[model samples]
Target: VLSFGLAGAASQLLGDMAHRLIPVTDREAASLVRSIRTAPLLFGWRGSTPVDTPALEELLLRVSRLVDDHPEVVAVTLEPVVVAPHGVSVLGA
Candidate 1:
C-alpha cells in the first residue's frame, strides 16, 4: 500500500476538487498516487482482473481536495486500492 504524511498550514479547496494534484513532491508522484485511489489490487494483473482507475481517481480527488481544503487534517493513512474481478473496494479511507 502507498502511504504518505502531509505537513502544512491550513488551506481549502473551496471549489471543484474533482481535479487536483494530491499531496506529493512532484507531478509524477501525484499521477501515481492518484491512480490507485479507487480500490485495492489483488495479486493478479494478467489474467486475474482489471482495476477501476477512474473510480479510484475520483475517490482520491475528493479526499485530496478535502485534505487540501481543511488544514485541521494533519495527516491521513489509507489502505491500498483493492481490485476484484466483480468490483473494486477501498479497505480504508
Candidate 2:
C-alpha cells in the first residue's frame, strides 16, 4: 500500500473534496499531453470555453519529465487532482 502525507497542515489543507478519475498509461499520457498542446479541443465544458488546455498540458509534461528524471522519487502520491476535458489543474503539485 502507498501512504501519502501532507505538509504545511494549515496552509496546504485541501478541505476535503471529490474528483473524477481518469486512468492513463505512459503512451496515453503523452498522447493526451500532445493533443492538448497542439489542439483546441480543451475548450467548452459546462459554461467555460477556451480553458488554455495547451498551456496546462505543457505544464503536465514538465511535471512528467521532472518525475522521470528524478530517480530518487520512487513513488508519487498527490491529491486535489483536477482533470478537465482540455486541461488539468494539479492542485497538489
Model 2 lDDT on a 0 to 1 scale: 0.45
* lDDT (Cα, tens digit) per residue for candidate 1, span 1-93: 224222123212222112334443344334654443231232244566655555544555556666777878867656554644455576775
Report the number of the highest-TM-score candidate.
1
Please report, as a residue range, the 10-residue window in candidate 2 with the lowest summed lDDT.
15-24
Predicted structure 2, TM vs. truth = 0.40
For each candidate in the order shown, give its overall lDDT on alpha carbons: 0.45, 0.45
TM-score against native, each model: 0.47, 0.40
Tens-digit lDDT string for candidate 2 (1-93): 122222335423653222112333344444553442223333554555655555554554455565567767665655665556555677873
Which ranges in model 2 have alpha carbons more than 4 Å from their true place? 1-30, 33-41, 81-90
